[model samples]
Target: MTFTAMVAQPPPMPDDPGGRGEDFGKSSPVGLLVLLVFLVAVVFLARSMTKHLRRVPASFDPPAGKHEAPEKEVAPVEKPEEQKNGAS
Candidate 1:
């Protein structure tokens, strides 16, 4: 009458070939073909990624210290003499 007694009972075995349940939980050839296709795609993708990674340059920045940048020159501004005299 208790749950333990119910659970202790062994599960019934599936009926022999006379029943339609014989093929239950079984995979077909189409499933195997799909799995193989996905595996092949993954392999090809991995190879392509490897090839692209190899083509990539290690550093995007230009070579350091190869070319020195020219120094900028600043010009001083001079006010007109008329404006300077008017302000004074």
Candidate 2:
């Protein structure tokens, strides 16, 4: 047998109960409205959660006795003067 012989024809398309694609949008207005409402709620919820999360800090304190020593200021180093023409 060949591939052509094994292939079957597709079923016929069903008749439209309500005039072609004319009622397509009419039937799903509620679904679209619900989806929009859900999307807006999700965005607002995420924003609120993010705002609250930012208020919390990651680390509470440094490890036991691992406290960093106080920083000290150091005087700036001075550069030697450049020699003039042929000076040893």
Candidate 3:
């Protein structure tokens, strides 16, 4: 009787197949530029938003006693004599 051990092994990595492995898992220059552009845009947007937020009034309610000119004082108009008498 004889006993044998069978072991499974993972495939080996290629040193450089068709120059594909050299730059594998590496970021490209274009990718870095795009990321930088996005970061810049985010910074500008944040600055703009902060400025606008600061300009906003703390409370939407107008300041006390600062509303429209005191409502004009208008005399009530008199009704027509016929309408007052009563129309049919």
Candidate 4:
């Protein structure tokens, strides 16, 4: 058979029943409620994390006490003088 004869025409599309059936992509109430719950949880967690983070210190050192003495610096050791040419 010729290519043109072998090719069959597609069936006609159904008539457009515009605005007849329920909308295809409408968001249900349950889905909206779930989304709202998720958003609220995110906001609550963010606020809570911010509150906790504000109490954290940048450095790990403990705060100094009023009665605590300051640390002392160590002095370097002096090297003994070398004896010249086997002289004791």
Highest TM-score: which candidate? 3
Candidate 3 local lDDT, 1-87, one digit each (tens):
999999999678777576567576899999999999999999999999999999988888877989876788899876899677777
Poorest 10 consecutive residues by lDDT, candidate 3: 13-22
lDDT by residue for model 4 (1-88), tens: 6555466796664687565445657879999999999999999999999999999999876576645667999997554554443366
- Once fitted onto the true fold, the runs of candidate 1 whose alpha carbons sit more than 4 angstroms away are 1-24, 66-88
Compare candidates 3 and 4 on lDDT and give the better one.
3
Q: What's model 1's TM-score?
A: 0.47
What are the C-alpha RMSDs, in order, of all predicted structures?
13.4, 18.4, 10.8, 14.9
Give the candidate order by descending lDDT.
3, 1, 4, 2
After superposition, the stretches of candidate 2 with alpha carbons farther than 4 Å from their true spots are 1-27, 61-88
Highest lDDT: which candidate?
Answer: 3
Q: What is the C-alpha lDDT of each candidate?
A: 0.84, 0.76, 0.86, 0.78
Model 2, residue pairs in steric clash: none
Cα lDDT tens digits, model 2, 1-88, are 6555566786665786465454554657788899999999999999999999999888788778878967899997554553443365
Worst 10 residues of 4 by lDDT: 77-86
Q: Model 3 residue 85 lDDT? A: 77
Q: What's model 4's lDDT at 41?
A: 100
The order by descending TM-score is 3, 1, 4, 2
Q: For model 3, state the Cα shift of residue 77 in Å.
A: 18
lDDT at residue 39 of model 2 (Cα atoms):
100
